[model samples]
Target: MARISTKSLTNRASWLVLRRNRIMTIGETVGILRDNDDFLVVTHIRPDGDTIGSASALCYALRKIGKTAYLYNNPQFGDSYPWLAEPYLAPEGFEPKYTVCVDMADKGLYPEGFKGSADLCIDHHPSNSLYAKNTLLWPHKASCGEIVMELVKELCGLDAEVSELLYVAVSTDTGCFVYGNTTGETLNAASELCFAGARNAFLNKILFRTSSKARLALEAQILSSFLYYHDGKTVISVVTKEMLEKAGANEKDCQDIAALPGRAEGAFTSVTIKEIDENSCKISFRTNGLVDANKVCAMFGGGGHKMASGCTIKMNSFKAADTLADIIGEEYK
Candidate 1:
């Protein structure tokens, strides 16, 4: 592994507070990327569009500059993102000099058996834990892809492939530009990526407009069981293992289900409880700028972006659902 020297940095290490984590300016992050060459990039466990796209864009940009880079082939990478994920999976037994995580904030989300090994981390989650030796985090940014896009531009310039990957990263995390986290800068980044030949129309169609029948059935079940609290400001939706089995839904069907109830007229906060097993569930929280979803999830030892976040609970699904809703209701008060 190449050593990182403070002397190589053009600017001093400037740290600013972001939700208990110290964040770096883009310039300082760029300095680290410029100094390093061999990189093994990893993403969070369920590997969302932001993680996959950011890792892919970074690897492509580094290779463009004649640097060695690879992405771990996580099994959770589904067929939906082959263009962005297929070409970059590192070969088995490949030894990486530096391990870098993209769009991953919490160590709990790290790949199995690979804990506390991140040399560097890039993320946009406000609740990011400073787990990496060098963390390039900007919680105010809508997506980590936004940060990665700028870094790629500064380092190797954006090609169409990188642009497409980054577009995936930004668009998916921002709910296709409709979520509360979508800022002017987020749209500006999207515009630049489109100009750089991202197939925006095609990406939007596949990522947002299309869904499988199983997903639709799951949505119907969740809607049937949906409940509101605190005068409809807090909405709760659940998908139990039984519901999934009955609906014939796969894991892919549950994508973005957490944000569904928030689209209702009077909902200020939404929670989705997904029962992974009889004794364990994952809770996803979405808010409309009223409540801090991160804080709510943190109550259960989970964290993520403010508008969207999640935590896992080791209780039965029904109990976890009631517990999370009660906590969110209390926080609203």
Candidate 2:
């Protein structure tokens, strides 16, 4: 794959912004939310805590302000954080007058069979494609949850439940405040959420402190077979469909598995290539201020923050691993 120059990438992003989206400030976003009603909040496919938490918090905030809101029933939604989302799910035959997307960077991330563009997008990804009509993007923020937290504060004030949901959004994206993306603002938002009753102790125990036995087994398998390149600066882990079955792990157990390889002492970049099927694989790229994970994943038509990004390759797991290794190796060279 050809590398994209910074200038070219900027131009591409600028073109996309000029084509459709209107970038808005946090205050502007709040104003729009206040003006809207009957909202249907959407999350990306394969929803993670950040997306789910952000969407749920925003949905809950909208409702608190006397607006009708519901979360789009994402089919891929796992049972990870049911309490945050279950009550806000859109019911059958529900018609939304407006659509809002949380934590989604591009239209490619939209749920299966989702039609039309988002009326508003709240996100914190530098690589956001600006697919929404109005966007509130804070790339400097660690998580979209932070942006949503500010919006919620302005909309209806942060209640305990909203605070807890936003805390999950912020903490998960920052790896419970351990990822390189965590910043002063990230910590401050977490502190405020804690003051508002985020249940950090319980959330921490569940989200970070504890891991299922199946997850441990899966980690052991990954550790035993990690592929190192560039003198161990880069590590690649492949998770096959068979591995999940053998470990008794489901998709939920595989959450944050990409961070495992990065734990290696000398590894600066970690790539997780998960076999989706025989024809395609999902790639998660994480970096520690070395190579740009976003740029690498963007080469494969995927983009996210500089430290973490992901893409899906239309290739078998092994082949995709080799392909990503080659690209990342070139970055090191």
Candidate 3:
């Protein structure tokens, strides 16, 4: 109604140009840290390398600065990722004043039953709704950890430990620097991380090299049950409870193999359903650029980026698949 302050208007104009790098002002970030010394960090569910890397890296930095930091326990990720489980791992009995979720744009993305106030949300996802009270958003950055690196450098000052963790964070998000999103700035950050003592070969082996016997078995089963629908325009994969038990596979294995079908030639969309329990299933969706899987997923109460998303289904697996196909077909047509 009244005239807006010139300084305030100027700041907003500059930010629209900066776009995705629109982070909280330096003063605002300092105020957030001043409000708490102890924090617990978590990431999006079905934690990927970027989410784990960002969350754990920040945890390490907080510890180095003599602050109490903890990471959420992931029982499903289990002992296989012992290296991840040990670093700045969340304390069992520590109840912190705040929880900071790294790389998570939406609170719905957190694991079930994780109850606490969200103090801050750090991410670069364009769909973010700013759910946290204090948000440091950089939707233009290559990875969430790139934003984390800036915070560490500006707030606490960066070091070898921070850089190493962030290297994992950024590298994973860039698809080892091969993805289309890699930019000159991304490479510059990575080169500095190398100087700060990030060991690429070692981390790469730990992250991309290992596969358990169960994982291999799950792969075979997925190959066997692989299906094509819509005249090969769509792909469908079903993992029954028996198939999982026979392969000695768990949820992580299914999550690992979920993306394969989407890459098939002529397939515009892919759908994978895992029997979560008797009457419920977990559905993961992926698509080529021609299809917007997010729209299909949102019809069932889930939402994500345009090409990939997921939703849980209360109906039996067949019914879920049929219902999902109906939604997807409409968009593709």
lDDT of each: 0.83, 0.88, 0.73
Of candidate 2, the 10-residue stretch with the lowest lDDT total is 1-10
Question: Could you arrange the candidates by lDDT from highest to lowest?
Answer: 2, 1, 3
Question: What are the clashing pairs of model 1?
Answer: none
Indicate the residue-level lDDT of 270 in model 1. Answer: 88
Deviation from native of the Cα of residue 49 in model 2, angstroms: 0.4
Model 1 accuracy (lDDT, Cα): 0.83
TM-score of each candidate structure, all chains considered together: 0.90, 0.94, 0.80
Q: In model 2, which residue pairs have backbone atoms overlapping below 3 Å?
A: none
Cα RMSD to the true fold for all candidates: 5.2, 3.9, 5.7
How many clashing residue pairs appear in each of the predictions shown? Answer: 0, 0, 1
- Among these predicted structures, which one has the highest lDDT? 2
Off by over 4 Å in 2: 1-19
Off by over 4 Å in 3: 1-27, 77-82, 156-160, 171-192
Task: Give lDDT tens digits, candidate 1, residues 1-333.
Answer: 132344544454323222233345677777777678778899888878889999999999888888889988777887337568889888878788888899998777886555448778898887776777777877889999999998899888987888999999999999999989999999999999999999999999999999999988888888888877888888888788888899898887777887788877799888888888889988888998678888888877998877889899899888887787788777776
Which digits, one per residue and each the tens of the lDDT, describe model 3 over residues 72-157?
Answer: 77554452343654777776787888788888877888855578757788887756655776677776677888888877776677
Per-residue error (Å), model 2, residue 22: 0.5
